[model samples]
Target chain A: MDQREQGKAIVITSGKGGVGKTTTTANLGTALALLGKKICLIDADIGLRNLDVVMGLENRIVYDLIDVVEEQCRLEQALIKDKRNENLVLLPAAQTRDKDAVSEEQMKELILKLKERMDYILVDSPAGIEQGFRNAIAGADKAIIVTTPEVSAVRDADRIIGMVEAEGVNDPDLIINRIRQDMVDRGDMMNIEDMIEILAIDILGVVPEDEGIVVSTNKGEPIVLSNNHKAGEAFNNIARRLEGEDVPLMDLNNSDSILAKFKKFVGLS
Target chain B: MSAVIKTKIEEQGVILSFNPDYCWEEITSALAEHLQEGAQFYQGSKLYFDLAFKDWRAEELQNLINLIESNILPETDFYFMNQSSGVERDNKATPKEQPFSPRSAQENKYTKTAGNDTKLIQRTLRSGQSIEHMANLVLLGDVNPGAEIKAGGDIIVFGKLMGLVHAGATGDKGAAITALQLAPTQIRIASVISRSPDEDKSKELRPERAYIKNNRIVVEEVNL
Candidate 1:
């Protein structure tokens, strides 16, 4: 493989909170690892660490990103190997500290060192347009903006996109999460077209509202590992798209039935 | 050569002057025609006229000013100056700074009855950022997907309105939202909340207006 292709650092962020930025980062990191690629996920939300717990590696973190940046520990010592996959590692944030503990220069240096060993470096950015968000996106080669179908979420996503663009990150892709199909059919919620038209950015994927995602996160297991969930399959498709595959979108309109599969195959509603 | 028209803008008003080498009559006629062609663009804007190095008499200068003023759209300010009259080099007369405030005196005239009734927001309300204004609110740019706005009166977006908007947020019931593209994620007028339909099958994409009618948010096409 080309040395430049060894690692591609991507930051998953949203301008608004509670829109699945960490969840998307964790799932995408795991999904990419399952494809036999060596992946390292960095939880850049320093003060409020959650990616490690979502990835089920919180208990195993004896050293963290701050320790490595502060030179209290070696980079290898801070890398926590996942129980499910040895190839997947996590650099958890320090929960006891704040975002100020890590500077933008330190994040860039850490990602540079990880680039030498990993195939992908996924950073989970904290919500808001503050220093924490800037720190998370400092060393990113690309950014993934996660949002929901709701109006508030889309508005924040647009503002974040504008900010990122102003910082010279152009063409950031979008991921619309927590879309409820029934509500969409009933005209109670904004649909995918409404989001795409307003945001006007390239869409990475759309994840449906899956209860399995909530349960899996509670158990410290990524939903992507559960093949039974529609959200899981949607995330897997997103991973494939990231890997440059042209897989068609999952038929979310007619989910959970054989007829849905038939509809997906026929490319019809 | 391009027309060399001189304008001296000041705090009091704009003053107009023309170069003696240029055709004053032709240029003045051209300016009047241009103003007529694009009245809305010049309306309410301030300009100063400078007649430097021109030998035109005071009566001629007055006639030019009157013609320009007559051609100008409503609310526009025009000031005239002539070098012959020694008003061009008056150091004490300073040009007014371009008004940076969103609301101007003329705009205020339209909104005075609603005095101090309009709210001005200067920052981009990011996702999770929300603002509730007791009166009419105007945004300079987009209201992103995760952001929200609630105003007691009309809401106008100089840019896109992509987030949730609640006009007449306190149940005034007659509030409306107008935008370059009114594809809001969620819109509410009084007690009614509605979302824009999916764009895949919906073809009627144009500038639109949303208002409350019979306790429901109704969207209608708007012609610019």
Candidate 2:
């Protein structure tokens, strides 16, 4: 196995549901693939399976994670190639089975086998800190916690961080998704600082609330693939950061005058 | 906090134990300092504490156990040899009385009382979760947010509070939250809410008490 092939497995998780864990995973995996890394995205949500659909690779699934774990299919038979990128792969979760069908050790072994060929293994964890969450984090060397700007989401993220820490994974990075900066400025929503004060972890990225993301999800394509979407650019920046590049965060202020947008359009950015 | 001398013997792989009353803070600090001074030399060394007259609660004992356990390599096993017969008896007695004696009467009185004294919790607070129970809201363990606990009367962490806390939520302000970790996300006593300063970050994680002062809550280092 190449050194990069023995890659770190990172589980993208949020303790609360509806906080965009699958969206972040698909976007990050796609963005990383665009950067020329061999990436495998595993949907560990089991019965609630959606990452495949979000990544636009649902129809290609024949064998799945449960199949590989149960010895009904080989590991390579389960990987669905991303239509947009040859280097990107998806290990779709079985939609018909419950989370208990796969054990933690089996999950670890599956990742270890994949590690021998992939540059990154991104496990999309299920919502709630239960058996599914534990299985997703079983083999991950790192974790990215996603939360919204609401008190409930932030609170759940905090709990997930503590659990991850107790599991001996220190310094899991934070990603505050769907942030409405306007609400933050108006004090109607919790600010990034409020979250950082409570989470006390290094932030990896911040994704603004973008209608384009919802539209793209509806169409079964992650917004990260589109160059025009601001959220796409943000995910790209996250990918660069993951590659150890110090990319400055995009200023999400909507007050950017027409002149600024015109300038950005002309590559004056 | 009194100072006590602790010695690590290479031959017996034992940490010479001193009485907890002999100044726990000093003794622990001194031992830590000594270990730091000879860190390279002491690396990979096993520690067996000679707990003779030392009396420690389960948490305190667990903390010490963790300290010794972490000091050694993962592959190496370590043990604390309790030399005193009374120490075991003391340890057993503490847990039985510690959780019950202080609150049994108060719990009875509160349950019997009604109305203005009632507390209500709307949702499950996860770990890291904290709530200022302005009255008497009881929760099953699920507060997951590095939470805070502030009650005007009594504060209980059904789950875990890895954040900040203040009991006496309404400023009966004389309230306290009892949890595995006294660390809270924020603490409120009556009209005042204060948080633990970032400066106290260290390995000395313990259950603590917080109270209100000139419109602010102050946390004091304490033992349960």
Candidate 3:
């Protein structure tokens, strides 16, 4: 029964492509919706309409962001309601058109309109520090940068973080995604501290590399739909953190961080 | 060497001042050569070419633009300002500007770190960030890998110093660098430079200091 003044637009971006920007956006949006928050996801990666597919709403899309902007459909008509969660909806990108199809002003206009209906509007940005990135962050209130444990990914994350900070996005948080347990165990990969040291930003949470992600993605179902999976549980926690809760960072050193949680639950410390 | 270009970093971005006498091709080539190594710092930063002296022809200017654009970092913007001021566009709300402190430069002949030359920084310096000061610099946080701190006087860090640091940047042999944790990727004093050993540092990390002793840089433990 809490209708806020306006919704927050968050842009999920990674300078290097395929670092789970789309996947994180999908999972986080779903998790927020599950928490009873009205969520709307925008696939700002124009010419690459993947969020709709990831959300399992690709087949039901009759209109998209470009359609709404170009006056081909009403803003209400372009919104595709999530089959599972009525509070969740998605405005897919135009696959045939490139990033130039939408200007920064157009993006701001679309996002502003959506803010009236949703508690959160998550924009999944296209990779690379180009025009698309400019358009994606144009209307964002906060930015969540996603990166992996590799050196290249961290470097790109640093660059992207610097850009976002330069763009005046206040205090962007980082999400270390697809972390390999063996690498952390072997001391071969950069740990959470190492990544944070280099990037110098707050940690949202770490999601272990899960094969469940691939399966759920292929099935057009977000992993966050169920808490059985560790990756899903990770997103669920991140949603709480985004909602202003103090969720601790997911432990990466132990592959199963839940064993300790159960121990604490049983009063075993 | 004769100077063809000079660059200054500011709150707005990097200001590239060109020698007005140089031709467009000459200026562009010189910039390309200089930026080949320094581009990593200025890449993805805003740049304004201060070309007040030489009125260039349109074709030559276009050619210069083609060459300079390739070397620029992604999302980096370059605007040409004319004497009459073609258009004024200022992006004031950039969320990611460098942590810049406005201060006057220090004199090289100064003997000690005194007055306003010394700066006290209370946060970590992440990768791609650099701090260059002419006097003593004190940092209360860790200097992560890929960052650098250069000073003409003593440099003391309350936390880890894991990046590149040059204490005697202005050829002052008396300058010393001290840190709570000194595991820098590279260290320099005056003209000498040293790097972290490639071999695994099995030894315990302890507080240490580096200074020029007998005309050579030496590292020693600082006993409490």
Candidate 4:
């Protein structure tokens, strides 16, 4: 059962900040783990780390990624086991150290070590195409770009796609997060087609604007662990697709019920 | 004797070549007058005093430093270089330095030739990237939003232009900006600045050119 060479490292990046890169990483890691795959989520945001908190493993962190890279602790000591999933773990970024503390070579070596133990290593990259960004994509086999349905977000995604390709991480997938159905119905927002036209990348999944995401995030639980929310279902399908499953795209238009609309209006879902 | 103090603007800093015959009094007065006349050009710029074998007393050097410090911004730094024989510093002139200073007699001689030069970039300019040139600029790709292009002369973009652009940056009123799709965030030509309209622009995309006319910037379609 040790198919160590089959381990795939995917870096999740978005050039702009506040576009749900961390949230997507947390949900995707959680979803993949629920599928019985060995998963290690690495929060590479360094000083502004959030993946640990998003995964509800912040309190369990004793040794972080920096500790392992700097040889202060063994790799296993830095891996925080998820409370719910036995197959899932997290390597939290150093809250005190900045991105410069970890070099690209160090990141490459660390990912190589993790690949032997984990089936999938999901790297949550920091925003901006700087040294931190370069380090995040250095050892990744593929990239998943997260973007919103706004012009600014799409523009930034285009830039990030170009940079990702230039780094030789070919054929990055796109995940359009936080899509509002009502806005699209009113033609007030850019639909999925317009974003695909601009970014020109294969769509992985689309998560509709879900209030459940905020609740789950505040609760330090990934939305994918919940079965009721549409976003959770969407993330589950995304995980299935990553595992080479042919899951159909979630139909956001037909799923908009009157009760869901009322819940959105009252800010209570 | 009235000795000459030649001022040269270089990449390193502004070099004031002090003639050996000039006394401390002559150097101080001439430098003060030059500073007063072109205060804007010297603001926040480093200044170097090239004393051509001219040695100064300790008190005289202190007075000169005080005078220049009081006149310019606090951020501006000044250095002294004695190019006497056996000195450690290299005496060779900078090969790529462009001597330019606004509102001075040297402006007409340097800026005109610099403005005539053109640069061609054959790739897309992405966000957080900026391109600034002393002359005309021709880009053969898209200029994404959050990127910026500034030129002393004209700017020509072969593809979509959605970034902030400034043509005729050095006050060349005749300079223009032409693009395949001219939907930039902001446009500046010479002293005039304009932005895209706040209303919805769902109209057809067309090639357009922007130029300054009657002291205002105007955009017009490029007839195919």
Candidate 5:
């Protein structure tokens, strides 16, 4: 662990709204913390924060990003510690101010200050190519773009990929969220292959559409905290990948035979 | 009336050659007629208005953009270049040269110009990326869906051609398009346009060529 000099900052962004950027940030941060890495989650959505609530740390936030930027509160005082995991903390966004309240320089400075003390900093960006989106990616070294299988989401994801590349973050990883394997098998939804063909990017992980995500969100606990759900396992795999571990994608069909058959069909086995 | 607006398919989009003699209404009505006649040709491609050296009020230009967006090409992206509000846009205006100019005056005497400038691209064109060349285009990689390539001469793809491509964009009629695996969302040659079937009918992959024959675009397998 001491071999690592400084932490890596990753900004998770999706050009479209409601594709689960916040949920992913909360869950990935929690999963990384479970792996014994100190994680700091930043809600950069400003005036529309959701990571704190999703992580069940909404009530513990006594100060926020704006408070720290304005020097009204110390950076340490603004960070809210996780109840379950002592290694995880969250810097909640300011609900009262818009994205204009924090400049890109201020956001970068704040992340730089936190980088010395953490192993990974995950920034949850807001939707659209606006000031908020720019401010979110300003301090990041890596990017994780989230998109669904729907055509609109994929199109927006492509646009976001272009924008991210233009902003000097090259070859950002993709996470396909809310993919329904049943619909894909029925030929009703775009499959993962079709998406990869169009987006032309490397996939980080694919999360199946699970109702347990809603239950976990309502309970204010990330699904990764639970052991029974496949979605939780998928997130845990993502955390392991971030830790420089090579983990095969979980079989969404919940069977080894079908995946084995697929591997054989593709001549991979 | 036909000379009021000359629509030319370029890489950026459709460039409407502005004739300074016509009034705004006449130009727009002519443009509307052109769009109606080739609505299928202009579909899925952005429209660009090159108002050469013309100074119009901002509101008037906005009205034109609004009319086109609301009435025609609603799904298409519309843009206007080289226009200034009240001020003379002299610097932006370059003298309109004849599009796809022949190499030499002596070459004009022959029925067919022997050489057309060809542009070669070496990488896969992803979605939202576009390539427009005034002559020929040779791509060495895949043209993914949502990407477009417009060329005035011919288009040859050494890899899969899955995106939109317009050959003979200057109305050459003799221009052709060929690809190793041609399954494009849409293909246009000269003034004709065709789209892929709703379902991919053919299970076999083959190198194919597309060209205008008897005023319609025809696709046939070509042996390399």
Candidate 6:
């Protein structure tokens, strides 16, 4: 059960807004915790803090990341425990202040402190290519680039990929979110190969554009908590891959024969 | 002037028909507005340049190419390289030292005219990376999206091309772009520019070459 290793900091960033950066952080954190690793999820979006709410720990947060950085609260005091899972913790951002509230130096020092106690530190970066992005990756050892299949999201993702690679973070893996298989089949959407030809990087996973993600998100419980949700399963697969497990990429393309059975089991079939 | 850029979505994909009659500025502005209105509708497709009748100038063509590129959705699996026809390109900017294939040069002298210096790159070009060659450029790997390859002469890729490529970067209309899988974000040849059709992987992938013909950019499948 002791899958603990030297803590690694990974920053999840999408240069475009609404490409599911916060959603990914919450799901991966919850999934890793379920896999028996102690993980700390940090919302680095500053005034746009969202990780706490996504993880359903919003009301429980008494102290935030800024409080810990300013020494107004201890690191342990700032972390809000997950109500559903005891192993996971949320070090959320301050909603009142902008990204300038936390300096890169302070964030790095805080990440170092968190490393001593947790196995993985996941930082959710804010949208746009600016100071918030720099502060988010300043202390990370690896990066995860998230993008939707849309042109604007992909363009911003490419810019973010260049920025992260320039920052000397380890090879950043790409996650193509909100991929609609039907659209791909109908010649209206970009498929995995099409995206690979452009991004030219190892893919982490692809999450189908699922209404379930929005539903689960609004419920304040990550989709990863539900086994039936394909997006949730994909997020779980990402967590396993992050643990250095060689998980096969989930075929999000409409091969529902195997998937439907995997999700629904009964004597009626 | 407002009718300079005409668009049609056919079974092959979207065809952006540029009217060579209008000046570059009018055409560029109209094209920008057209693309902005349909970016979502054109997200994953490549567009063809119907440039068959226009007399293209290298500088004006370059500006037109840049304008199309600046307006489209560059990411999202969309590309702009196409093989059209009937347009004549300006081939006046060939460099002095193109000798990569002396044996083939004689055969190409009358037909494949352009470029002297040839740069061969052997690795995948990732996003945001740009490769510029004053003469001819040949890459052996995939040119990913957000990355661009600009050559003053001809550009060739041995693998997939899904990025921005400007052949005849210095305005040689005789320049052509060839790729094993010739789908790019945008393509510029001499002074004629065109975007790729929306990418649809379900189609059989083939090696195709794009060059100007009859004053238009045309794409034809190549055996070798």
TM-score of chain A of each: 0.95, 0.94, 0.93, 0.94, 0.93, 0.93
> Candidate 3 residues A1-269, lDDT tens each?
35667999999999999999999999999999999999999999887668876887654555678778766589889888998888899988876557887889989998998888789999999999998999899889999999999999999989998888888898999898999867887898788778989998888888889899999988789999865677998898889999998777665445356666323311100
Local error of candidate 3 at B213, Å?
Answer: 95
Rank order by lDDT, top first? 4, 5, 3, 6, 1, 2
Model 1, runs deviating above 4 Å: A1-4, A255-259, A262-269, B1-224
> For model 5, what is the alpha-carbon lDDT of residue A73?
85
TM-score pick, better of 3 and 6: 3
The C-alpha TM-scores of every prediction are 0.53, 0.53, 0.53, 0.53, 0.52, 0.52
Better of 3 and 5 by lDDT: 5
Error of 1 at B62 (Å): 88
lDDT (Cα atoms) of all candidates against the true structure: 0.75, 0.70, 0.77, 0.79, 0.79, 0.75
Give candidate 2's TM-score: 0.53
Q: Which ten residues in a row have the lowest lDDT in candidate 1 chain B?
A: B97-106
lDDT of 6 by residue, A187-257 (tens): 89877777777877788888878898988887789999986777888899889988888777676546557
> Per-prediction fnat values?
0.00, 0.00, 0.00, 0.00, 0.00, 0.00
Show the colliding residue pairs in model 5.
Answer: B11-B132
Q: What docking grade does candidate 5 earn?
A: incorrect
Per-residue error for B21 in candidate 2, Å, reads: 55
State the C-alpha RMSD over the true interface residues for candidate 3, after superposing those residues: 20.1
| Interface DockQ per candidate | 0.01, 0.01, 0.01, 0.01, 0.01, 0.01
In model 4, what lDDT does residue A158 have? 98
Count clashing residue pairs per candidate.
24, 31, 10, 0, 1, 34
Q: What is the lDDT of residue B107 in candidate 1?
A: 45
User: How does model 2 score on DockQ?
Assistant: 0.01
For model 4 chain A, the run of ten residues with the poorest summed lDDT: A260-269
